[model samples]
Every structure is written in structure tokens, then in C-alpha cells.
Target: MTIIVAGVVVLVLGILAQVLGWGAEHHEAAGHAAAAHGAAHEEGSSVLIKRILVSLWHSNLFFLGVSTIGTVFMAINYVAYAGWSVMVKRISEALSAWVIPGGVIMLLVFFIGRHDIFHWTHDGIMDKLVNGKPNPHYDEIIAGKSGFLNLPFYVIRMVSYLVIWGAFSWKLRQLSLQEDLNGGTYWFHKSITASALFLVLYAVTSSMAAWDWVMSVDTHWFSTMFGWYVFASWWVSGIAAIALTAIFLKQAGYLKGLSSNHLHDLGKLMFGFSIFWTYVWFAQFMLIWYANLPEEAVYYNQRLGGFEGRYTGLFYFNIAINFVFPFLGLMTRDAKRQMIIMKIVAIAILCGHWSDFYLMLMPATLRGENGFLIEIGIAAIFLGAFLILFTRRLASASLVPVNHPFLDESIHHTT
Candidate 1:
């Protein structure tokens, strides 16, 4: 409750500052008055609301991505019939509980922020001419992609992804809990079948989601690997989250007898996927930087040196902190097995990825750029809420899945 109040105080005060135009005045002092207006050209009012929505959207999406991956982790384990995760399965389920609230927040922000966040929603942006008269604000690029990027279709896709993923999250949790009571293979087998279907749908929706939620912010730019790129970041972060939570629970005696062997596997998965995220990040950047296509290269150009070099520092920082720290910190076999090291590295990687999302959204959406205070406030709100839900869900469930067929295996598991 204290966390929630602090988060709320920060969130409300931060937004009140924006609503009062304090944000605009700050950017004006930096001589970005025109840039600030241009940033919200289609806003039809103050840019303040847009900035609030953008920050909220970023925070919600970050939490949502991590939450969604919890379900993804569970689904993958079920499909592969992997038993090693039985001990930490409840943690992942709790992490996934955020999807319901996250999705609702997403839908709310999208509507209230339509004109602010997505320029394509404006009346004439898609038209070369209105009534055969040249529309001064027409965007040829966005117009060309109108078929797939239209507001109606985009909203439909977003809603579909959330509903389907949320249902699976809730249903899967119920099935797992039922397994605790029934103590048979029936719920377990049902989970495998349900999981198999979710994976197939997730394979497509997750990518489509990346395109809709994150990539579309830069409506003019598209990448072939973006979906996988987003998924990789989500996957690695979810793994780190699971590992971190397991450690926390063990310390609290919620997960007693959790061995170094379990931590070792978690560490290995985190290390491997962190590398995977690096690979994806490098592959996208290197390919774009090398090919130097005016269209494609512009994406990096703006991020690397554009926007008055506001994002320049973060661009390089994004790669280094995300790739370097994880690689060196978690490289040793012993490092992955140590509780203290695992906790530190997981916290660092989670923070690194938060910055990763900042890089992804801030440059495109909040070009005027407010200082970090508001961002911190906004993040605190979502982070606080997510923790409340996650902890409650975790407490509601049995720490160990006693009825799980692989329970004995997880207990005696070795690295």
C-alpha cells in the first residue's frame, strides 16, 4: 500500500505538471518550442496530454511485454514437456497476472491518445488531396501503408491479442491450481494441449503486437526482424524476472530448498537469451548502418544523431549496458549459480531493458523531451501496481506444484 501511494503521488503530480504546461515551458527554455509543437502537430491542443499518454504507454507496454512473456514461458515449458521449471512455475504464472490490467490500460491510452501518439489517425494524413485539393498535411509514406496501418484494423488486432492472451493466462492458472487439488495427470495433460494451441497463436500475435504497439510509433519506418527482435527482448527479460523472483521467494522461505542447480539453469537461459537480444540488436543496426538505405537508414540517423542528439547518448548506452554487462557479469559458470550474483545481474538486465524501451519510444514519440523526473514517476506507478498484483498472485498459489508429475524430478534436479 505504501508503494502504491508513493507511485500514485508521483504519477498524479507528474501528470499535473504536464497538464499545466510546465513541460512545454521547459522545452521552450531549451529552444525546442517549435520542435515541441511539431512533435504534436496533430494533437489539436496542448502537447502535454500526448507526453503523458506516451509515458504511460511506454510504462504499460514495458510491464505488459514482461507479463506476456510469463505466459509464453509457461506455454513453452508445457509444449516441450519440460519438468525442470516446476519449482518456479508459480512465479511465472504470477508474473503473467498483469496482462489483464495492462491490456485494459493499453486500450484506454490508445483511444485517449489516438491523435497524440498515432499521426495516422488524423483526417487527411492518408490523403494526397482532400476533395481533389492538395492537402497540405498529406503524408505519402503513411498513405501508402494505410491498408495495414488503418485505425480500425490496428485497434482490432490490438484488442484481439490482449483478449486471447488474457484468457489463456487466466485459464492456465485455473488449470494449474486445479491440478493441486485433483493431483492427477488430467489437468497436466489439459495444460499441454491448451499450451500447444496458445504457442501457435502467440507465434503470430506476438510479432503482430510488436508491429502494432512499438514499431508503429515510427509509422514511417518498418523492419522485417522487428517482431522477433521484440520477442527476444521479452523472452530474456522474462527469464531474468523468473530467476529474480525465485530468489526473492526462496529468501522469504516461500521456495525453500531451491538449489543452486535450479539457479544454474535459470542463469544459463538468461545468459543465452541476453546474447540473443544482442544478436538481434546488432543484426538490425549493422544491416541498416551498412546498407544505408535512405528510408531504412533514416531510422538510425535520427536516433544516432537526430533529435538534437538527445537520444545519441542512450543509443550507444542501450547496446553496451544491455549486451556488455550481461555477457561479462553472467559469463562464468559459478556466477550463474550464485544467489547474490544472480540477483544483481537480473536487476541490472531488467533496468537495461527498461532503458531499451525508452530508446525505442522516446525518440519517436516525445521528441521535445522532458527530464527524467516525470518518467520516473510514471514508471513507479506501473511498477508498483505490477508488484502488487504479482505478489498477491504468488501468495495465493502453492509455491511448489506438488501434484506436478515432474515435482520429484525438480526436487532432485541437478545442473
Candidate 2:
């Protein structure tokens, strides 16, 4: 009930802020041109709405990626037969329940808000030529990629990826429940087989989804490392979430068998993945910076030089929060083992990754428009919704898997 109420409050606040923000933009535009107040107001409102939608889209994707990768965490454990995480696997599974609804919301946003976020989808841009030469509207680079980026094919890929992910997540949950009821190796074998297949599907679609959903934002730019970078961000965020959840459950006395040893493992993952995320970030930036190609450099220039230099602060700040804090905060073994410190670091990593996604997304979508209220309000809405969904799912089942083959191993796990 707390989660539900909080979700409602945050969602209402976000909607209200969006309305107020649009109104403010409209009023400012009308003030600038009294005679064309109506026209200017309409245009301004449209632009502001687009900005809000793009921000919401990115926020939704951040939460969605976190949820989807939670399932991947479970699948990896199942395939590896890792015993340490058996006690906490249910937390990961519960978190993954968000993906079904998240995927639906994502698809709806893409269909309705594509024009707002995707430059390539705007009308008159695909075929437009500038003074009989290549104009910015009809970008030759984007045009060349149109065969793959066209609306029909793009929609198909989006649907296919969501279906695949949703199907696997559902199957895994079902198999786990059956395993709980039946308590046999038969269910375990089935889960292992399904997990093996899901991993393969995940490897391909996760990267392709990154390209379609994120990399395509800068339609003219390309990066081979983007998929891995995105995976790292999502993976690290997922691990942090698990650690945070485990800490909370442990404090509540709900997770009796979960031990500090299990948390230590999660902490190690969170620490290691934070570095991995930074490495991919640096690799992508270093290669682009080294080459200094006009097309490539333009991406950073817009982000750092500013939409025209407004986002300069965010460019550096993103690295500091995502990389610096995690690197130093969780360096010591004692730090990882302490619940208080782990909770703080986990929350920081989650926020840092959200900022990272915002930096990747907003430059392309919002341009120079920045507002604290809108950003926070939109994020709160998603955060609240995720909590509501995750907590409700968590409540529906035993906090720990009771009949797993490795239950004893996990229960007695120590470091």
C-alpha cells in the first residue's frame, strides 16, 4: 500500500509538473510575440511536450533495462550452478517481473513518441536534399542507414525482442514455481536448459536492442562498443539493485538464510562491473577522441561543447558519479561487507547509471533544454512505479527458494 500510494503521488506530481512546464513555455512564447501568440504558443508547447516525452522515454528504458538484466543475473547463476546466490535469486526474479509491463510501456512510447525522440523519423527529412546538395534534413548518412532503420522493420525488431525477452522471463518464473512445488531434479534440468537458451537469445537481442533504442538516437553516429557499454551499465545497476534489496530484506528479517558471504559476492560484482562500465565508456570515448573525425567528434561536441555547451558540466559529472564514487567507495573488503556502506554505494551506482543514460539520451532528444523539476519528477514516477511492482511481486512468493537443489549450500555459504 505504501508503494502504491507513493507511485500514485509521484505519477500525479510528474503529470502536474509536465502541465505546468508546458504552460510556462507557452506563456513565454506568447510574451515574445503578442500578434502571433497562438501560433508561437502552440509551437512552444509542442517542443516542451517532446522534451518531456523524450525524458520519460529514457527513464522508462533505464528502469526497464534494470529489470530485464535482473532476469539475466538469474539465468547466469542457473547455468553456472552457482550456490552462493541461491538464497537471493528470488529477489532477482521478482525484480524481473517489471519487464513485461515495462516492455509494453516502451512499445507504446515508441509508437506515439517516435517523432519526438527520433530525428530520422521526422517528415521531409528522409528525402529532403539541401539546394540540390545533401541538406541536414535529408541526411545522406541517415538515409543510407534507412533500409535498416525504416519504421516497419524497426517496429518489427522491437516487438520481436520484447516477445523473446518476455517469453523467457515468464518461462523461468513458471519453472521456478514448479520446482518449488515438485522439488525434483526434473524441474532443475528444465530450468538449466531454458536458461542456456535464454542466454544465447539475450546476447544477441540485448545488443540489437541497444542499437535500435539508444544508438539510433544519434542516427548518423555508429559505435561497435555501444552494446557492451549499455550491457555493462544495465548489469552493474542490476547487481547494485540486488545488493540493495538483499540488505533491506536482511534487515527486515525476511531473508533468514541469506548471509554476508552472498552479499560479499554481490558487492564484488557491483565493484567489478562498475569498472567494466567505466572501461567501456573510456574505450568508446578514447577511440572517438583519438580519431577526431568530424562525424564522430560531433557527437561529443554536441554533448560537451554544449548543444551549442550547456551540457558541458553533465559530460564530466556523469563520469565522476558513475566511475569515481563506485571506484573509491567500494574498494575495501570491509566496505563491501558493511550493510550501511553497501546500501549507499548501491543507491549511488543506480543514480549514476541513470545520469549516464540521461547524458546519452538528452543531447539527442532535448538538445539544450534542462530542468531539475522535470527530470526529478519524471524519474520519481518511474522509480515509484518500479518499487510498487517489485515489492508486490516480492510479497507474492517466499523470500527464499525453499526446495532448490543447492539450498543447503547457499544457506551455509560463508566467505
Candidate 3:
């Protein structure tokens, strides 16, 4: 109830801030100011609103991705017959609920906020002629890629990815519940098979989804490593989320017998993936920077250069919070075993990765200093709602998989 109220309040406050901001801009535009100034202000407000909407949509998508990935992580454990995670598998499964509403909200944004978030959807942008030869609208490069970037196909791809992810998530949870009730190897066998299949599907779709949802925003830029980069970012965030959720439940006495060993395993994952994310980040940047190709370099240049080079600071800050902090903080074995330290690191990574996503999307979509308010407001809205759903689902099932074949092994698991 508190979470729901907070979600409503944050969402309303975010909308109000954008509306009021637009109203002020509109008022300034309508004043007896110079026509150029008025037009500039109007354009600024428009972009600001668009940026806020994109950030809101992206944050929601981030939640969805991490939640789904949390389940995917569980699936991998299922397929691998891993015993360490069984005690907390329910928490991972509970997070899957976010994918459903997240997908619906994303679809709504794609259709309604299409013009605001996607430049390719705007009038004459794709079709306009350049130099009396080809596409204009300062996006000839994007036009060249129009065969794959068209609206109809883009929409189809986005929907397909969501459907695939949502289906697998739903089916996995159903099978998990069924296993709990029946206590048979039949359900277990089916789950393993399904999990194996889901991993294959995820490998392809996760990359494609990253390209469709994020990379295409810049339109002219491309990155072969982007899919992995996104996966790494969200994957680590998922691990942190799982760790945090387990800690919360254990503290509440709901997840009795959840030991520090489980946390150490999760902490190890958080530590490893943070490095993986950093590697991807550097590999992507270094390759692009070293190659010095104008097209590819423009991507980083926009983030690093320009008068409003605040993104440069965020770029480093992203590394600091996501990689540096976690790397150093969780370096020692003792640190990973400490619940207090683990919780702090988990919370930091969550915030850090949120900033990572913010850096990825916002620098390309919106500009200026208003991002802090928008980030906090949008995060509050999504995080609050996410907690409400996740907790509700967690409550719907046993804290631990009571009938899991490896239940005893999991409970007695040691680092």
C-alpha cells in the first residue's frame, strides 16, 4: 500500500513537473519576446517533455529487462542443476511479474510517444531527399538503414521480443508452481527443457531487443557490442536485485535459513559482472575511439564533447558507481559475506546501473540539467511499483521451493 501510494505520488509529481515546465516554456514563447527566442523556448520545452517521456519509458524497460533476466538467471541454474540458488529461486521468479505490465507500458509508449522518442517516425525524416539525391532531414545515414529501421518492422520486432520474454517468464513460473504442488520429476524435467530453450531464445532476442530499443535511438550509430553491453549492465543489476530481495526476506524471517553463503555467491556474481560490464564499456569505446570513424566516433563525441558536456562526467560516474565501487567494495571474501556490506553494495549497484541506463539513453535523447529530477521521479515511480508487484508475487508462493529436489542441498549449501 505504501509502495503503491509512493508510485502514484512520484508518477504524478513527474507528470506535473513536466507539465509545469512546459507551461513556463510555453508562456515564455508566447510573450513579447523575439520570435527566434520564442521558437527556441518552444522547441526546448518540446524536447524536454520528449526526453522525460523517453527516460520514463526506458526506466520502466530497464526494470522489465532486469526482472526478466532475474528469471533467466534462475532458468540457467535450473538447466545447470545448480544447488546454491534453490533457496531463493522464488524471489527471482517473483520478479518476473514486472515483465507483463512493463511490456504493455512499453508498447503504449512506442505507439503513442512514437514521435517524441523516435526521430525516424517523424514526417519526411526518412523520405526526404538529400542533395537532390536521397533522404534529407539531417538523417541520410539513418535513411540508408531504413530497410531495417522502418516503423512497421520496428514495432513488430519490439512486440515480438516482449511476447517471447513474457511467454517464457509466465510458463516458467507456472511450471515452478506446478512442481511445488505435485513434487515430481516430470515438472522438473519440463522446466529444465523449457529453461534450456529459453536460454537459446534469450541469446538471440536479448541482443536484437537491445539494438531495437536503445541503439536505434541514435539512428546513425551502430555497435556490435551494444547488446552484450546492455545484457551485462542489466544482468548485474538483476543479481544485485536478487541479493537485496533475499536480504529483505531473511531479515523479515520469511526466508529462514538463507545463509551468508547464498549472499556470497550473489555478491561474487555482482563482482564478476561489474567487471564484465566495464570490459564491454571499454571495448566499445576503445574500438570506436581508436578507429576514429566519424560515424561511430560521433556517438561518443556527443556524450563527451559539446558545451553541455555533463554526460562526460556521468560517463565516468557510471563507471565509479557500477564498476569501481562494487569492484573495490566487494573485492574481499569477508566483504561478500557481510550482510551489511552486501546490502550497501547491492543498493549502490542498482542506483549505479540506473545511472548507466540514463547515460545510455538520455545523452542521445534529451539535453540540459533537468535530468536529475526526471531520473529521481521516474525511478521512484517505477521502483515503487516494481516493489509492490514483486513483493506480492513473492508472498504468493513459499519463500523457498519446498518441493524442489535439491531443497535439502540448497538449505545446507556452504560457500
Top model by TM-score, which number? 1
Residue-by-residue lDDT tens digits, candidate 3, 137-250: 445676688899898888888888889889999999999999999997888889999999999999999999888888887777899999999999889999999999898878
Candidate 3: stretches off by over 4 Å: 1-45, 128-138
RMSD in angstroms, all models?
2.2, 4.4, 4.1
Summarize candidate 2's per-residue lDDT along 1-415 as a digit string, tens digits: 5544555565566567656665556435333432232221122236557766787788889998999987899999999999888888898898887898889989898888887778778665668565677654456687788899999999999998889888988899888888888897888889899999999999999999999999999887889999999999999999999999999999998888877788788889998999999999999999999999987887798777644355788789888888898889889988888999899999999998998888888766656554445566667777878988898988987877788999999999988
Instruction: Please tell me which predicted candidate would have the highest lDDT against the true structure.
Output: 1
Q: What clash pairs does model 1 have?
A: none
* C-alpha lDDT values of all predictions: 0.84, 0.82, 0.81
Q: Rank the candidates by TM-score, best first.
A: 1, 3, 2
Model 3 weakest lDDT span, ten residues long: 36-45
Residue pairs whose backbone atoms clash in candidate 3: 128-136, 130-134
Q: What is candidate 2's CA lDDT for residue 126?
A: 67
lDDT of 3: 0.81
